[model samples]
Target: MDPQVTLGERERRTWAAFVTMRRDLEGALARDLARDGLSVSDFEVLARLDQAPGGEMRARDLAAAIGWDKARLSKHVTRMVARGLVERREAAEDGRGQVVVLTTGARQVTAAAVPNHVAAVRRHFFDLIEPDELDVLDRVLTRINARAVEG
Candidate 1:
């Protein structure tokens, strides 16, 4: 291992804490979304579709946006389509490409779930951190994400 690469005691502790926090946060959100008959993945897909232009995005683009592989996205989209949450359409500009479009039902489900999800996030995560801490945390996470993508 590189001499400067090994984690020190503080770094180890910080990494462990961050991992635990993220796991617990995701668990909480998953539970909240499950109560509404949706998984975290489902919520994410719907949310992304809702935000896209015309509430639709090419299947490949959606996969890229969510960092999921094509096969994984296809499976998720298949399930969502069965649940009446979304529909697949042939991309107008690309004969071979398909798009996933959010259904009205999906829009309604997301509209309802988002407020509750936000409240849960505020209660479980944001409320525990001070405003200054939040700012620092955001900056740190942003830099970490940037470095990760660069690497």
Candidate 2:
């Protein structure tokens, strides 16, 4: 957008509301995850790892998958290691690389967390939208995501 081209009233309100709603909703979801002894970020990592082939990924790949920088992923993985949720192993195929592996304990944790987190999503988000609104939301988000990747 051109800096001199001012956002119209509708655009301003929509942006403000969207930002506020996203923050508030994220907070609520995080709180819900706290009860499961996981943060949202923790769950994101664990869930992704759980789905990965062999329940592992190169640390760099995991970071990219979650859209986190290496530093953040390293720090978080360290914490998770302390929690016994994951392990960092030297990749045998490439000695210099590190792989993040999901532990049995974390798989259990993810399994336990999934149902509750899904329920919370339904309760806090899905329940608020009408069935028809879902189609519109999915389409809008898909278009926005496609455009986002283009840049």
Candidate 3:
């Protein structure tokens, strides 16, 4: 084993804490979204589509944005389509590519979900964090994300 590959006591504790915090945070959000009849993945997809120009984005682009593989995205999109949350149509600019568009139902649900989701986030996270701590977190996460992409 490489000497540098070993984690110190502090590093191990930090990693464990990070994993637990993320899992708990995600679980809380999932539960909150479920109360609105949506899954966490559904909220993520709809939120991204709602923010995209024309409230639509190419399927591949959506997958990339969400860090999911095309197959996974396709399956999710299929389910959303069946539930009337989204529609898949040929991309206007690129007929060869498919795009996912938010449906009217999706818009209404997304709009309603946002306020509750924000409240949940604030209650679980923001209310406990100082403004300065948020800034520090942003910087730390940004740097970590950059380093992750480098690999």
* Per-model TM values vs. the true structure: 0.94, 0.93, 0.94
Kindly list the per-residue Cα lDDT of model 3 for residues 18-55, writing each as its tens digit.
99999999999999999999999999899999999889
Backbone collision count in every prediction? 0, 0, 0
Task: Tell me which residue pairs clash in candidate 2.
Answer: none
> lDDT per model, in order?
0.94, 0.96, 0.95
- Pairs of colliding residues, candidate 1: none
Question: What would you estimate as the lDDT of candidate 2?
Answer: 0.96
Off by over 4 Å in 3: 1-3
Give lDDT tens digits, candidate 1, residues 37-130.
8999999899899889999999999999999999999999999999999999999995888999999999999999999989988999999999
**What are the runs in model 2 whose C-alpha is more than 4 Å off?**
1-4
Please provide the root mean square deviation of candidate 2 (C-alpha atoms, Å). 1.9
Model 2 weakest lDDT span, ten residues long: 1-10
